[model samples]
Target: MNEDPGRDVEQEEEELFEHYRFKVDPGQELVRIDKYLIDRLPNTSRNKIQSAARNGSVVVNGKSVKSNYKVKPKDEVAIVLPYPVREIELIPQNIPLDIIYEDDQLIVINKPADMVVHPGYGNYTGTLVNALVYHFDNLPERKSDYYGRPGLVHRLDKHTTGIMVVAKTEDALTNLAKQFYDRTTERRYHALVWGDVEEDMRIEGNLGRSFQNRKVMTVFPEGDHGKHAVTHVKVLKRFGLVTLVECKLETGRTHQIRTHLKWKGHPLFHDLEYGGDRIVRGTTHDKYKQFIHNCFELIPGQALHAKSLGFQHPKTHEWMQFDSELPQGFQELLNKWERYVTE
Candidate 1:
């Protein structure tokens, strides 16, 4: 139940989008309004959240307020989110899409490195979802504000390039997302990391948020909020200082492969976030921007590539797979590394 102590119910529903009602507890005290919005709506972007609060969509104790407004415990707040339509009208443009495989139910796309899977803060216009919006005749209803991102079952690092699957229908979305939850979907990444891995090493660790930064994930011993993560590393080739390795994902945690590799002392080169920059650039340093890219070379971003994807077809129950070759950029770096090792 919620407080309808003051305003009209129908008008309120039409006026504000926060249909998910909430009451502030006395224990959860004195936090900023924008942050409260985040806690309330996990799917909405921070930028949209701030704007909604500023525009007076947020009411504390039945009073409109700004994003920076702070509140004490036991505050009563009402929030409204933008109306969610069953189907949103998204204009499709003729953007380049790397089609790995396609069927009636799903599409396997070799997402480029620089391309975003969905839209959010600092990224709105140019995203995989935006392209997909135009690619499909209709998109299914979004579950949350992250709705801007449609039919996306998994995500690659903004810098890490790899294979991604886009669902064409609601049924496909359900089947694919469930596959990930059940750990049935198979994903593999090719990382040209710096330094040699210690002979086909298997590094397994629990992952959770970093203590120093809330924005980054870190490896930790068994503890609160930590999820069990398993990654398999196989040495593909050794290049003196750098080694090209293939990573297999058992559990898809945020940045699981990258974070695990970094923890295992064989960080991918040019990885500024989790220890990739430490690798010594042998000779050719000025050739590429970042070292991660998507599965195929169709996009731009990082040196990590999604080389392959395997899954049981949701509808057909047939075993299917898609393989993407390393982008020329990644190959070029490997060549230079090989040359450096030779000379």
Candidate 2:
């Protein structure tokens, strides 16, 4: 499995409701499943395991089991549970949000680039969550089993600009979270990548953090490691050496699009982590190199935008879709590319 840099297994698992599997040792003695799990799973409490078992979330040998069930030798055990919560003081900051739509149930915002979605280790202030708590009251905070991100059902990377939907009430939070987890929500991203992608294609692979570089994700084509992820790419426009494509996610793993596209021989322009910051498909001329450098300077990070989002409204059950214009920097970069191609 891929590991997020600077985060432990528990933290990573808790970021989303995750499925965990364990194999009882052949030489192991009989023990209550909940107690056994409490020992094996770090930071997870006995009450949480028991609750999951009572809810039929714990399974052994293909059948659901109660917390009192004794785990047998060579038993295949699996459980579904949300990540444990970390106690951190959430300080609300008076940061302005670009609200796209808001109602009693939810709020949608056009997130700007370079803004971290939530506060974490090195990012303790100026986060979208900080802004959220300041601007909105009674926002549903994720349960202890889920990540501690208030009102957030999903997230975007710090440098990735896009649209995000925030839940205002618990019902809305649960419903929206379920939609995202079930892959029922629609999310489309526009990305500028190095290389001229010849045709539309689907990229399927297992994504995991690289052992060599803990901060960057890598594709495991053999499926031997990591979580399964899929991204569909459709060419929108081409700029000789680089291409703009629409990426539709079939599964939303961490850094899924960036990792998948990199594995497919196309990295987003100026994506420093994925090697797109350097010239990968361009000429050796000094003038071309300088032009590429100038282009990179226009964006804070990778040339990717979360342009559209669609989901069912929890309160009304109505299908809702929202589209966002590209950020000014991204638009200007595209304009520069167009001008270069035309000239």
Candidate 3:
């Protein structure tokens, strides 16, 4: 039950590194380290492996090595590099963006649901990055020349709506990144959960990729696995069957709010990944079931929104805050619930 002081939260704006390890066979012949990795790491090229070496990411037998260094028998090779398995070309597409604020150093956006933040795996296009590429003419070019991502200081889930910031300059990027890393930024989410929440509460746990489902996160109550996460919640309104709540994140782990709320026994309404799509509470009458089903249909996914954000201006060092209204569907769903409870 002990908690580590260090928390693990994945900000979408931050670059994620993929970790790799390889142990050379005892009888393996010496060969160029770069060539050795090219055969082992799928889709990676010689140039990319060499670049990783130059960045001190590639190690052999516990020491960083040059790409041309010989791989000896029993050598243990490891690397940590930005993910995507391979480079991808970023194409600027003329997608619409709901821009909230913009300056020479950064841009703020009120993102909509159903838009992936950046491209990866099956989602290589139609993301916020593609739209950003088309929208902004002067994005800061990364020093590492990493492909396909830009300007992002943090990200929202594809199905989650809310405010986000993007950096426009290298200095802005660095300083903004530091702010997020130091946990100085403020983020608030509005979530409609399946059951009435009577009291305000704080939830804490270690969050990690679910061992049973790699696609989603799970809570490790013992704090022995995953990264530490904390969320504070206040009930905003109460329907006998459901509750509207505001969640403030202390750590932004991937799916932190969703998973922690699930562990707290109040998974968000219509949260398909965490089994909130079903009638977790309320009357078992067919009418009630049908009404719940209809509510689920109104919102495309989980009824959660990143309603507000606060952070220091990366350049001016001024305190900046922004808020967004709930999306149309979320408002409509809540209205329906209010009517249901009153009637």
Candidate 4:
């Protein structure tokens, strides 16, 4: 749990909204919301449209309306929901991977920092998904319920290094997704954050994209915006100006730990997105500044690592857990801090 966590819970590459807005033509006839959407949104199923309306993800004039609601002439309609992925030509690349566990149903990889999980608009190649494609031919194919992403049911940030699981079959994909959706899977992270966090803390907040900056996520205390998120933090070590802490995710939200810790005034060390890149503590002397700068160079991104993951097997129903060694940069950075504190 890097102290200053940022971003929303739904920032996955495949979890983006398929947004549509329309003004009913003046001569249009009255039609059901689902029908109206189906006529306009190509390749969308009636069931998909109805499900969106049922979940209040579809709205008319800023108010959530049901599927049965009849559309009138000149009525404004807006739809914002996760749309099925459009199939794209996926090119496989023979990139190396750190495989920790592999079987017929699933494969666990200790993903390195700075690797994008899947390809998107700007990122087309050199991703974990590409490597998986080259390495495994029988990886589960995408269904209509989701956008075209192979094998992966969840994602990690481009800079977040940690353990991740990929499904090899459709059964494994569905089961893994359900486990994550039900919050039954266990995820633990290690983060080095600014400030001396002397004790354990639990935080609950509604997380959504920032109003000021759409690129980042923010917590909504009123619970009116975004989705509910929870995180538990326990202090593992204290180094006066910084602290090493362990985080247990109660809810998997994009940048939940980073944003929550930022809300608590302790952003992760060198986290560029959450204001951790600056010196938030310690003496302002030149020598101290140099030391901090050197530390920053050791770990260029946020000091966050997904240390452990636990979940039940899809076929066998047996519980499985895996732990990963910290990346070289993170370990060396911690050692430097330890030596500095002692000296």
The best candidate by lDDT is: 2
Query: Which portions of model 3 show Cα errors greater than 4 Å?
Result: 1-86, 138-149
Candidate whose TM-score is highest: 2
Which RMSD values do the candidates have, in order?
A: 13.4, 5.5, 8.6, 8.1
| TM-scores vs. true structure, each candidate | 0.66, 0.78, 0.74, 0.75
Compared with the true structure, model 3 gives a TM-score of 0.74
lDDT of 4 at 326: 95
Alpha carbon lDDT of each predicted model = 0.65, 0.81, 0.78, 0.80
What's the ranking of the predictions by lDDT, best on top? 2, 4, 3, 1
Model 4, 42: alpha-carbon shift in Å? 10
- Candidate 1 lDDT over 1-343, as tens digits, reads 2333332211211221234446778788688878877866755667665655644456788787888889778787776545332233444655778878876678888877666665555555677777876665443433332234346666776666667787665445545654665567788889877676668877788877688975567888554666788888899999767789988888877777777887877777767677675434344454332332222232243368888888877668788888888877777878766665677
Which pairs clash in the backbone of model 3? 9-253, 13-154
Return whichever of 2 and 4 wins on TM-score. Answer: 2
Q: Residue 308 CA error for candidate 1 (Å)?
A: 0.8
Backbone clash numbers for all candidates listed: 21, 1, 2, 15
Query: Which candidate model has the greater lDDT, 2 or 3?
Result: 2
lDDT of 2: 0.81
Report the candidate with higher lDDT, 2 versus 4. Answer: 2
lDDT of 4 by residue, 120-148 (tens): 66777888888888877544653334322
Arranged by TM-score, best first: 2, 4, 3, 1
Q: Weakest 10 consecutive residues, lDDT, candidate 1?
A: 7-16
